[model samples]
Target: MTTSKQALPPVVSTATWQKELAALRIREKAVTRELDSVAAQRRRLPMTEMPDYVLEGEDGPVRLAEIFGEHPQLIVYNHMWHDGAEWQCPGCTGFTTQFTRLLGLEKFGARFVIVTQGPIDQALAYKRRVGNAMAWYSTANSSFGSDVGAPPDAGFAVNVFLRDGDTVYRTWHTDGRGTEQLSHLFGLIDVLPYGRQEVWQESPEGWPQAPAYSKWATSQEIAAAYGEDK
Candidate 1:
């Protein structure tokens, strides 16, 4: 049986919504400009020779260079998967879902890879959830992650690299909002209350949201926390 959808309460689109759409477009252009600036700034990251490193993959131990595969730049995003945590971070997983495919990234002389400090299975499990099997690897106890600014306990962010001849350089990095800028769609839409018209995710009459709150809650916990009907 096809149950009819609930009708929303009568409402009028007034000044409230006017700035919303306009802000969205404004944000879209702003984000694009920000990205262009980021690209230009990326040219300044400290240079480093291809440092020796071991990354255990689905196959086994593989050196880092293999990811380049003739590409001049490498964009490795740390997915911030914690092994001992009760659950995976849905926010991070959700963001990765918006991440463009490697082919798209590779076309620009850049290849994106997700390196995690968590156990292989822990990280792999989350990746499988999003079906983002993009070139993933495990750093184990190596400082490669922290050295790049993502302390295991602190979580992960996007890090960009440039390969010039045999030398590799750390060019750019983004954390939180900066990382949110990684995906233009997420920046202009998800960050907004009404979101984009293309993806229909209308906010409830009043969706009370807390930007930063108590400890993060799991899906099940959230249901209980909101007194949502089972």
Candidate 2:
């Protein structure tokens, strides 16, 4: 059963809509340039030597440098995991589901993986439950998360590292919304009339809204909603 479509913006002639779209394009281009400038500055940031921390994966113990393999660049997603939670973080699971494959990153000489504070068996169990294909490791006894800016209580983070021979250096890191770059869901939502359907969005009056984080769901819940067996 399909739900009725929500009210839309006022209908206008093609020419009028084109004019409005063109106006918006100007600001979009400005944002594009600003992002380019910021990226350029980010590239020039100095690197810091990273500790050779060991993380636990399905195949027993592994060193941080080993994760990079033959690639010089490594991207790690620090997923949030409570000590005795029944499930992994919904936000992290959702974002990670967007990255079902990492073969494409190989072309750019980058390896991507996830690190969580949960135990190895628990992390692998959740991976199987969510059908995530990315390499996941446990930092339960390692300070790799905190060393890369994710405190024990922090939610999530994305850290980038560069390896020079056997030495690994931290190149960049971001947490919170900064990690949104890994997910395309928000980009699609931004184009919708209601824009994320979040209360904080600056939508027109009467537009649908919900409390922030209310839309989150576990991977199992999401799969079951879509009629996929888990």
Question: For model 2, how does the per-residue alpha-carbon lDDT over 71-130 read when each residue is reduced to its tens digit?
Answer: 999999998888877766788888887776678898899999999988899888777777
> Could you report the Cα RMSD, in angstroms, for every candidate shown?
7.6, 2.6
lDDT of 1 by residue, 1-230 (tens): 88645434345587867766688899789978997896787665566554766677777776676667699888888877666876556566555555545677667888878888887766666565455546678888566788887777677788877777656767777787677556765556566544442323445654433344222344344324332242
RMSD of candidate 1 to the truth, in angstroms, is 7.6
Residue 86's lDDT within candidate 2 is: 71
> Roughly what TM-score does model 1 have, to 2 decimal places?
0.67
Judge candidate 1 against the unseen true structure and give its global Cα lDDT, from 0 to 1.
0.66
Off by over 4 Å in 2: 1-5, 223-229
- TM-score per prediction, in order, is 0.67, 0.93
List of clashing residue pairs for candidate 2: none
